[model samples]
Target: MTQSMEDFITDAFEQNYERIRLETGRAVTPNIKEAAREQVLLYYRRMRDVADGVTDTEVKLTLPEQRTPQQRKFTLEGVVDIVREGDRTTMYDVKTHLDADAAAGQLDQYVQQLNLYAHIWQGLRGEALDETAIIATRPTRELRQALRSGDDRVIDAAILKWRPCLNIPLDEHAVEDTVQRFGTVVDRIEERHFMPPAVEKLKAPIRPGARQPFGTAVCANCDVRFTCDSYRQFRLQTTPGMNPERVLQDAMNEYAASSEQGQWVDANMETLNRDRLPDAEDIDRGDV
Candidate 1:
């Protein structure tokens, strides 16, 4: 008998999640585990229809002999999945974007990356490409809410409305330009040219085409944001006319550090009579 997708997902989740739990030596919280299960179910439901003929996944492709003025020839590497039918081929690049709309906002970036992949496939592997697409694995907010609600009807409705696959039109003509840009970035990295975007740029959308701000969508997820001057400025600008010290204290309190770590942050903040913060006094006065 064929196993149902729901049962399959449950089994797969138990096996894989257990492996991860053992490897990491960490326990998965109930909320996080459920969210992960929902994410996997969403991907499987959307992909099962179209994931046939997958020839390879985690495919590493090399683009060779890229040149920059500051550096000699070098190679760029990327991993993607390839699907084949007869002589035609398609490439799939999966990302963890918030949803299709979020993915669409940054479609041009994906197009450039895919174009580089296609160039390598055609030039190096001598393959015929039929299509290129991005599969964003994040479940929609409505679906997540419905799942949390544990209502079957709402889940079915959300599943019907969700669209995860975004077909991107590849421009092979743009490959050279993209490669040059990649080489330029590599040269900058090698030269230790670590300049970041201006504060104003971080406050604005990542690009003119995108609606999400660079600070929220990009900087928030970055590892080195706390050390970035522009991000610091961006945070200050987000709450205009606020006391810098108060803003900093609030930010520190919001960090989700491990419980095992000392409560030095809270303890230190207590030393500051937070009652003296301007906003707190204003709010208190308004209440009176």
Candidate 2:
């Protein structure tokens, strides 16, 4: 499906926001992705006895109609590995190929997917779910640790805060008002010729010993490797000018200097350090 502009912006904002929270030790959203992963793991935990068991199962959850004029109705597609022993109602998502460490690292993405599904599940079950998890065979030890460290309360709280953004108020004139505001912004940008600031010109160049990796976790499975300029340059050169190490150092220095002088940095340094820098490895895996 074609991506929406709002979705892209929202993803970017959430990623940066979460990263800042992690780096600065600020309380942000709990790891929803890990929660979903645990839900999948739980499904597999039930089927340890059945060898050569179920490959894939899809669960469709239907929700009740809402009183809102623009309520969103969607479906939750759950891939299950096993059904619980006695109830057969609960299921799990087992990770067979994806490693636990890797999954844990990408838990945010998983949580986003799970929360998306949970929204649909709530609609279907006509009640809020207490918890949802995933199951995986690989990284057994890592997965076990993750399960123990899982926190549903945090995930639920994050979801509550996130719900408003997900389900934007779509009352009368909402669409028109948004369109009008967008037009105004476009006009303003056009009036200024849409030129990027000088500092924004710092491009992402590739360097040596860089490994550009992409997967389902980040970039939503988009083939951004080819499209990312840093990736291509990293493949060709041993020293890409815009290596993340240099970039991060520059950002940190700039932030420190700004703070020392009581100057506003304008950019969210915490967000950049936590989120964007880490992802830079995936986009341009070159050593600084």
Candidate 3:
């Protein structure tokens, strides 16, 4: 019987559940939904075939049974493509139907996810992965245009960093540190502290003859859409009722306050300007 995507995800979850339980002393919530997993796996399978010049029947990932008191294990989330040639292995993320440029822009997160898996895999197998990549299954014409304009340097750097983990010894301390870091990231996300720049960035108005609409399937299905006041207000304000200027101003104010508390900048004029926006009178009255 062909294993369903949920079955694959459940297997992956089970593989890491023990470690997670030990680390957090609680059940680990499954984050990757089956739909997302299936989509990712489909892409990974396709890309792997293309890169490896082999069919799915020929490729395999050597996942071992749970062993060692402090062994690391890799849980495939949404791997879409894999290319293996001898000792060299390159994995590709299949972002089917998403804007390639947008996917490429946020490729850092994907690279990090791949590296985390690679780290766990290396711990288990005592070998390093060669490279990681993101391949858009159905890239937009504009994204293809941008790709032709320049090579992706950011992705290259992220892949390079993954190379160093190969020689790193996987001991209890290292495994603990990895788990702790992962937990911290998870905590931040749970608390919404890791929220990215506002939806305006994601929904930047498309120009004429550009992309008619600019959003991915993930964005469409995002649970936060209703909760995200900005996105909700943006949609409601299709006419003149919704004020983009006010939305921007409020976001800027919130950002400034957070920045000040975070101490993300040195005491400087630029920081001061950000902290203090010009009042209407200060601007029109030439109070500068």
Candidate 4:
């Protein structure tokens, strides 16, 4: 039997609520929860009707060290939201509940995930995917029927309105490079250089209004800030509402070769030496 939209929405929303809470270390209120529910419902509506492709569905890839023979180090996995079956298979990561302003920023780690998916597909099954896409939606009351008129026609139609930015493309060469970089990261980890790297790893920068308005620095949404040595050092070295220029500049440079929408810049911005960890550690909290 097919489940009603309400049932699926409840299940998806609850799952999202729990996953976000665990990842970000905060509580979500009823209003936020309801907004999330609406997003899930909206996603289903599009998959049911609007997409031009045939039979789009979510996917997951398991990559062992063997897949990256050059690296020969670690295994990893990624879950992709849309893999459309057709003359040429394409991958897309679906984003929901974001406004026009925030939709692009919300695509954190999508490039990495999608790249790995493409790389592994070529090795295990066949050639790389023909294309990659990110589908982000801003919901409105009349979105489902808006597709009928098309051509950004929904822009002027409704109250608390919604619009979608679809078919945002990913580059083939960039995806290949990203997959190669993933292997390099795993290769480094496997090296086991007798300690952590010289650089300090940082957390992601979150959505300004939606997830972490208070965050101005890279550690803004870090759940273990009080207990982590790296986070503590980040605080002492920087002030709130201020992002270090060096970090920002480096991120910009890295994304220079990529598209405006897909080149996401978040944390992992700055690096602190391993020698400095002792100074940043809190002995009371055992954050050494």
Candidate 5:
């Protein structure tokens, strides 16, 4: 329910790092807040190698004040974590996953998001980025051990575990495709159309072992599942005669994972270290 360390690092670091990053982008450089500056310092120390060739961090495609202009231009708004701008612009996004395979499966989404940044860059700079990269940071067992014990070893292991990937960069065709894809979704929303990506529930006992049904990966974090009629119907008809107690247990599990905003959600914003990553080399990719 809470934000992961990965998310926290991204956000907190951005808030601090952007002072210098944006200043370098603009003419008049301003001082960043103290709290934010500390985060930036910690990040550079922990992940020093990534600091190389890093022209900028926390670059935003659409500023809050620029929204009207951006929407008027029918643009996609996004943030690019790192940018190496020169004869050719290179973009990078930071990702955190359990492993390389888990990070690999999310390629399409990352590519599309990066493409939005490319479009924004081209609109402002008159040229598109040449390529994009993903910097996936996955904690290993030893790092987990270091984390649990708050040992200094975590600082070094974290740097060694980072995985860099060169992915398909945004081109003319990709930008056009992105525009069309977003357009289709916008049009559907305007038309009030609906397409529930239905998932098939299994006829198993109420094990409730954090195993999300296939095709319902989105549901695992969705708050509406608590009230979704479709989910309810599927659960009732296909739970293999699970009793009321079992059903209650399933709901409790959903509550634990739900990201929907509420008071409880606000209070649970601390990251869960134990749920960071499974230790087993061949562990099934459950929502754990």
Candidate 6:
């Protein structure tokens, strides 16, 4: 007896979902769970026939402490997957996105991170790395639309056309520079220097790599936005001009004259008017 692909996918999804729940104590809604299952199924379907040359997965690397005279000790660590084919080796860092090219502006940051990993691999571990790339698992909009439509033909067509891999260039020379910047950040943390950026800066993009204002893209998603003075100031600066007193008065008037209250009063008045009217039976018997 052979196991079908659908059955295999279902078993894999259940196992992974359970593991995630147990490890992280994270609960997802039904829609999110279904989407995750679809992603897994799509990945498997695409990679089923391709030779990945996967030698190792989830390979954790801890770089040695490069900064000296520090109050506290810290090490940079990262996880990556390695693919080896004969003498050539490739390192892959997996990322999830709706579009693979959505992070194009952040390429430099990725390069710096991957360069550090390359340094650790080549310089520290004496392992040769031929290439480094980001395997973005982006389930395309077409596939998602097809899934929503529940059309098998459309889904199959979309799945076959979907491509999610993005290759990143390896910059070995930037490794030392990236490491120095990391040391500076660690020093700031150890010194308890947690000063936030200015309000004007918060209104600007987080970095040259970002596409939108930091307030819109990053600060809006932050849980502590309401408590942050900079965020409050940014919101005030961006909000449309309005008379606070007039707005307050208008709100009060609206609450007082709400449609539901008006409806209730009208209904009561109608009942009272009906009660005061002459009875049809009395009029008919001439007994009014």
Best by lDDT: 1
Q: Report the lDDT of model 4 for residue 30.
A: 47
What would the per-residue lDDT of candidate 5 be over residues 65-106, giving only the tens digit for each residue?
Answer: 221212432446666666454576677776543233344544
Over the stretch 1-288, how does candidate 4's per-residue lDDT look in tens digits? 125756866886788766765565445444445656765655555444435353445566777654343646556776655445656666666655444434445454556566667666666757557776665665633554564466454633531254454444454465556656777766665775323211133333345454422222333434444444454444445444555665444433432334422222211111123223555346767877
Candidate with more favorable, higher TM-score: 5 or 6: 6
Worst 10 residues of 2 by lDDT: 162-171
Q: For candidate 3, which ten residues in a row score worst on lDDT?
A: 161-170
* Tens digit of per-residue lDDT, candidate 6, span 161-244: 876665677887898788777887888877876665688887776557555676655565566565576766676666548565
Q: TM-scores for all candidates? A: 0.76, 0.31, 0.39, 0.46, 0.53, 0.65
Report, for every candidate in turn, its global Cα lDDT versus the true structure. Answer: 0.76, 0.40, 0.46, 0.51, 0.53, 0.69
| Candidate 6 Cα errors over 4 Å, as ranges | 1-6, 23-26, 45-52, 68-72, 97-99, 138-163, 195-288
**Clash statistics: count for each candidate:** 0, 29, 6, 0, 0, 0
Backbone clashes in candidate 4 total 0
Estimate the TM-score for candidate 6: 0.65
Error of 4 at 171 (Å): 3.7
Output candidate 1 Cα RMSD.
12.6
Q: Is candidate 2 or candidate 5 better by lDDT?
A: 5
Over 4 Å off, model 4:
1-32, 45-56, 66-72, 82-88, 95-109, 137-170, 183-219, 226-288
lDDT for position 245 in model 4:
62
**lDDT per residue, candidate 1, 1-288, as tens digits?**
224857877898989976765565455445456767877777777686555457888899987777986766788999989988777788988786456766776788889998889888888998889889998888755667877888888887888888888888878888888888888888888888988899988888856766678787777767777778887888888978899878766655445344413444443344343333457667888942
Query: Which ten contiguous residues of candidate 5 have the minimum total lDDT?
Result: 26-35
